[model samples]
Every structure is written in C-alpha cells, then in structure tokens.
Target: MTVFILVSGVFTGAHVWEDAAARLAAAGAEVHAVALTGLGGPRDAAGAGIDLDTHIGDVLAVIDSVGVAAGREIVLVGHDYGIHPVLGAADRRAERIARIVYLDAGMPQDGVPALAAVLDQSLRARLAERAGAGGAGGLGGVEGADGELPPPARDEWQRWGSTAGVPEAALDRLTALASPQPLATLLQPLRLTGAAAAVPTTGVLCNGNGASIEMVQLRVGVGDPALQALTDPRVTFFELPTGHWPMLSCPAELAEVLLRAAAGEGHRLEPAGAAEPPVHLRPFLLDVPEVPRERAGNVDLYLPDAEGPWPAVVFVHGGPLPAEARPTPRDWPTFMGYARYAAGQGVVGVTLDHRLHDVADYERAAADVAAAVELVRADPRVDADRVALWFFSGGGPITADWLGAPPSWLRCLAATYPILAPLPNWGMVGSRFHPAAAVAEARALPIVLTRAGLEMPEIAATVEEFLAAAKDCGADVEVVDVPHGRHGFETLDPTDESREAVHHAMRSVLAHLTA
Candidate 1:
C-alpha cells in the first residue's frame, strides 16, 4: 500500500487538499494532508515566532506519525510554497520516502530560500532589497502585523499563479481559507545533506501557469546545467492542463496524476548529449560569407564589402537569457548568421550585447539597444538616415519603445518568433512592454514580423494578439509565417521552409530600409 502525504502551498492548509484527498482515498491510497503551523487558521492565531523550522517540524511530525514500515511506502507531494518544507522533511527522512512530487513548484536548491521562488519579479526584487537593508533576518519586511506576509487580494490572486480553469466558487473558497504565511518560511534558506538527491522525483507542471514539459525540454536542450540535472533517469514529468491550484480546479485529475506519480509512471526528458552543440551554438542555416566587422563598445558592426555610408540593420537578440550563458547573444551563430547575411546583401549588420539578463532588466536592455543604434549611425560606413531595428525572441517587447514614437531616421522594425506580450507567469503589471497595445501609435513606420507555426502556445498567443491589434489599427505590418517551423527554427529546425522564411523576412526589412 502507498501512503501519500500532501502539503499545501502558502495561504492555505490541509483543508485545501480535501477534494483531492477524498478522490485519492476512494482510489484505495491512504492520504494525509498537512496543515502547517501558521496556515489554514485565523490570521490572529499565527504567532510571530512561527518560522520555516516550525513548518519543517510540522511535516516531520506527520512523517513520524505515519510509520513507513511493513510494506507501506510513502510518496510525498508538495505544492507551491509547500515544497520548501517538503524538501526539508524529505532530506531528513530520505530512507523512508519512496518518491517526491514537485507540484507546480520550483526546484529549491540548497541554501536558497523560498523567496527566490516567488513568481512576482517586482515583488521579489523589492523583498530582496528590503532584506539586504536590514528588514527581517535577511528575509524582508512583512506587510502583515505579526511577521507574516498577507495573502494576495481576491482580484490580485493572479499574481501568485494563473487562475484559469478554477471555478468561481472554488476561488471564493480558496480566498476565504487563505492564511497569512510566516515571513521566516520564505526567508530562511533550505539546507540539505544530499540525502534526498537520489530519491526518485516527479514534476507536475501546470501548463495554464506557463510551465510545461516542452518548456522544460527547451530549457534543458539549451544546455542549462540546472535544468539539465532534471534530465536524470530518476526525474520524471507530468503536465496538468489546469491552473496552479489543481486540487481546487481539477481534483480528480490531480488525484490520478498523484497516483501515477507514486508508481513512477510519466514522461522522461532526454538529456542533452555532450557531443552536440547547444541549440543556440549550432551552425547557422544560411552559408553566407563572413563580413569585415569592427567592435564599438558592446556593439559589433558587420560592414558590407563595398560599404561607404550604406544602410544598416541592427539585429537585437532575445533574452532573459541565463546570466552565465556562454558566447553571449552577440557571438551566437544565429545572430552572426543574420549579420553576415545582411552584410552579404549590401547592408551593414549590427549586433550588440545587452543587459537583459532578467525579465526586469528590459529598460536597461532597451537603453543598451538605443545607445548601440546611436553608435552605429555615427559610423562613417553606415547611412545614419536609413536604419532598421530587427528584434528576436524575448527582445520583441523592446520594440514597444520605437513603435510608440517612430523617428524619421528609423526606417523599419522587424521581429522573429517574438514574445509581443508579457506571458501570464511574467507578472508584468503595466503596459510598458506590451507591443500589442503600443502598435496603435505606429502610423507609417513599416513593421515586419516572422512567426513560427509550431511556437509555444503562450508565445504564439501573444503574436496572435499583436497581429489582431495591428490589423485593428490598420498598421503597415507584414507577417511572414513559417508553416512548420518552431521557435529558434533557424538552427533547431533547419528545413527549406525555415530558410525561405528567413530570406523573406530579410528581404522585406531590406526593402523598407532602402525605400
């Protein structure tokens, strides 16, 4: 018999698992949902002394009460903020645990606190700043009176995770049952002795919250060491189509998934082989000759052989790329390929290194791009009056700056496989980076967009939204579609269609620049 121990995330407690627990019980598995020290009760009852260790004790107590002996196996399931305590307890009780399930939660590394896993970028930044400035034991100041962080307001619940597929009554119940979370739980780092590392693990990704098996695979394929670790044979994945709160939104499905996870039955991610280069470093599809290049600050200018004051195209690479990513975007084969290809076609191709290392660094990255453009135009070999800015991937949002107010010298704007709107999980509060909303201001400036047919659903939805907004405003936008192409198709899916799409996009941008 398998005994499943459940842990709820911040704001809720064991009660949050009632529906799922009943379903699991009916399926013949023993279920025990843990309500941590300071949660699932009145806010006043949660004392100031409650901390992460207290919650760890709470989980440990449950583990001790449910004896893992006599042919009984234990499967530990942690949801959201609950993963921190779950990991802590699992680390101590490694020998008794059969498997650990990370349900819509981040993989908490040793010495990293739960705060690092907070989904809200701005809030996380603020909290970190406060913690560094002597807030509360390096945790940060809490909004609640008794050293606890208050639960999100009803309308603002989306800040925590996506609410899609959750019924209205369930949401009301969730809000009502929400409890203040102890600040120390989020501040204190999780310590491990490497005991639980060998335990088989399962990840239940919530697709509605913008995490999926495909995204994980894509991240691993890029050679991210942290994510690459998940490719281990012992680690498996299962995706839920509902929102973050699967218990409230789809209890029966969640119960089934939990049961399968207990059985170690799920899809496995393929490890990135050491022999092959990462997707970004792969050879460019187009075999264009290398052009003469000169470095100016962080920007690289690829000059056409016959250039004497020629039109230029500034290619901006997409990111929120890992800070440790090698070769940088400027040195990546795709950017190099595009630059070289443009130079071969008689235009100066410009590529620059920007500081968009995190989602919040868009402003800084836009500044870097603007500064690079100014430097490029000042070059004697480039025509200052006719210039185009071509963006890719996550860099697409930076186009909002230019689209809202086009300069006379700016000839065209282009984006390929771009994220035109903030993803649901991004927690972007304002419309500052929303290109779809800004397209209305782009009256005469020519726009070129290249879309991949097999792009990620969330990203593709943004592109569709942008296209609709562009059409509504009658903006002069030309879309180039690659029917069977995926994101980063230039190198990842090097087919005839990909090549043609790349050429068509380049031709369109060049035409606008020369016109």
Candidate 2:
C-alpha cells in the first residue's frame, strides 16, 4: 500500500498527472492524483474567500475520506502552488506520509502568505493584470490597480494551456472562465517549519525554461530547481529536459524515472537493453519426470500439486505455431515474470504450443485454444470449477475465444492485450471467432484483462469493444490498465502493486470458484 498522491500546481487538474500516473502503476507503485482546491474543479460547497487553510483542508478531507492503505507510508507530491496544501497535510498526518516531492513548488513558512511570499515581483506584476477588477488594489506589488486579463499574456497562457495537446472544446471551456483568488491566500506568507523540513523531500526541475522550473526561475530571481534543493539534506533533485509538463511530452520515459525513485529498482534506458540478442527464442517445457506427470493425448502435464485437485491456469504464448516449432515452456529462463508470479500464487500453470491459422483467420486459432483446454482438463488435479488461463499478447485472441466457450476446466480467464477481432477496423470483417459469444457462455466467471496504459490511442477503441463484449456476455471484467507501462509488462520487473493487481485478479477468480 505505497500511496503516491500528486498535487497539481495552479491552473491544473488531476488530469495533469494522467500520463505519469499510468506509468507509475505499470512500474508497480499505487498512485493517486490530487486537484488543489478551486483549481481543478470547484468544491460543491466552496465559495469565495476560500483561504489557504481551506484549500489544505479540502485536500486533507479527501485523504481521510478515501482512507490510506493499512501499513505502507504515503508519498506526497506538490507542484508549484500545491506545496502549501500538502505541507499542511503532512503537519497533521506525517505518520501516514513516507516522503514529500515538490515539482518546482513554493516553500512557505509559518505565518507567511503562500503566493505573495514566493512569487517574484515580475510574476506578481503579471498576476495583477489577471486578477479581476476588484483584485487590482488587492495585489501587493507594482502594477496599476486594474485586474484585467491582458490580451497578450492571456494569449500566451492559452497557447501552452494543455499538456495532451488539448482539445478545442476544452480550451473553450477553460478560456471562458477566469479564476479569482482570495486576498488572504495571495497576501499571507507560507507557514513552513523545522518539523516539516525534517521529512524527506525530492525535487524535479524542468531545465528547458518552460513553466515549472525554468519559466518560474526566469521570472523570479532564482537558479534551477534541482540545484536549489541540493543544499537541503532532505531534498534530492533531478533535471528533465522539458518545458513545464513532462507527462504530455515524454510519459513513458518520465514514468520510468518516477518508478526508479519509488521502488529503488534498477534504472536503465534500454541503451543496449531494449532487445535481447538472437537465440532469445526457444522451446519452454513444464512437466518433469521427477514430479508426477499427467499424460493427456501425447502431452505430458505437470499439475501444481497432487492433493485433491487445484484450479488449473493454462499459460498461452504468442506466435501461432506448434509448441515444438516456436515452443512456449511453462518456465522460460529469458523472461517469465508473469509465470513466476502466477505459479507462486498456487495457480497450476500450463504452457501450450498453439495450433497455426491463416494470418487473419482467428477461428482456427480459437479452436486450438479449445483443444488445449480439453487437454488441460484431462489431468486429475485440474479443478473444473477453478481452472483459468493466462494468455499473452497475440495469444489473447485465441484464449479470448476459449474463455467465451472454454471447457469446464476453465473457470476464469486472464487476457493481456488481446485483439478484439470482432471490430470492423484494420480491414477486418464480421469475425467467426467473436469473443462476445464465449463471453456470453462464460458470463458467470471473473475475467481480468491487462493492457498497456500508454499504447496507441486507438487501443482505447479496442478496449471499448472488449468492454462491450464483457457487458453483452454478462461477464465480470476487471480491466487493469498499466500506466506508463508498455506492452508485455509481464517480462519486466514491475512495481509491487502491478504484480499484486494481477495476483488479486487471479485470486478473485480462484476465491469465487470456492465461494
């Protein structure tokens, strides 16, 4: 239960961390996003004159309402203006927090107002213009008292308004509203103290001179963000080459960096590591003569245990071919993170050499999955009520069809990045191997689908199709979108949460079998 709560800076919503949040989940950390009060969206009950404490209180109430996990410490991240609110949260719930990260955030001290105390004169003057009519005189510094959105400055902000390249409709909605700030929050200095500084802190600075570190530093008289934090023992820093938002421009890379910071895991850019050498392919075998073997039609199987009977989890590999041709072993030395985890959790793992099919004809492939399931059930230890399957990448299509109409041996299904062949895209016509049909048959069972969070946007449509299939089939679907993670995350050293999620999905199916 390692929780990472990310707070947004001014003029942003939880949507800001959309990319990075997904990546963190893929890397195995539990992540949540935060919206500063009066920033992302209005609190239903919030009114004007909402001071800094109210904002901090707003965020704290959310944390309390959701409730932290049982034992792990939470990580608090504050960006720009959000520093005040998180610091206040830490003051009250420090025990729940393990570390605090600031993304070029302002540091406020006791009895000090947040905005006025940190902003340089240049920023203050610029802000004065945007402050409504009544806000002109309220501003502390040098500009004449007219709080108006100057055409030029407003235009500049508008240009860089969105991180996801922004949609025109959203841009219109945001531009329609000009936010007003409370005089108290603007004038009051921050209330930082010795106690809070004692906690762990990390800073990420954008050296590209965009909005976060560079832009602010350019306006305010300060050096780079990471360098500034170096003097503080509690704070660690890193520089990313981007303007303001790294999530929009480089989600995958940034997510890796965040994951490294969280798990203390290895961090390599796949420099020489992206692809394995030739001969990375080979046949993977499961059953051993030492262990009791269950013979089923020319196939020798290894059941997890020989007690009464345990649920079977037939593992399918991608690349349509015979097991001997492009063999898929139960435990592959090259990479079997998924198998290692599922098997460790007591699932009777089965590795199959699949049957071939026309490149586009999935019905043939679907039939192969059916045959494999039948072969699996022939074993004595395979509990008909608890049997499941874990299908990898391209193998998903075959297994998806099996789940829709699998033998009694399969009680559940786990598909990773399966292709919804029923869809009309990619020149595909009405598919005979419509997974929706099998879903209808297996509607009563639990199904877990894992997909990469940062895949092509078109994948969303594919997912929608699957969701429709699940709904039509009356199946229970638990879709875990691994954020910032690429396809085939099973091969990597994912975060604990990511692995746990998969395990939980498996356990749920197993538990339901008994229930």
Give the best candidate by lDDT: 1
| Residue-level lDDT tens digits of model 1 in 53-155 | 8898999998999865697889999999899999999999998999999999988989998888887778777777777777555553456445667887788
Candidate 1 segments whose C-alpha is farther than 4 A from its true place: 42-45, 137-144
lDDT of 2 at 345: 52
CA lDDT for candidate 1: 0.87
Whole-model Cα lDDT of every candidate shown, in order: 0.87, 0.53
Q: Write the per-residue lDDT of candidate 2 for residues 293-381, one digit (tens) a residue.
A: 44454334554443656666666655333324322333343224444434445556566555542234455655666677776676566
Name the lDDT value of residue 339 in candidate 2.
41
**Which pairs, if any, clash in model 1?**
none
Q: What would the TM-score be for candidate 2 when compared with the true structure?
A: 0.40
Number of backbone clashes in candidate 1: 0
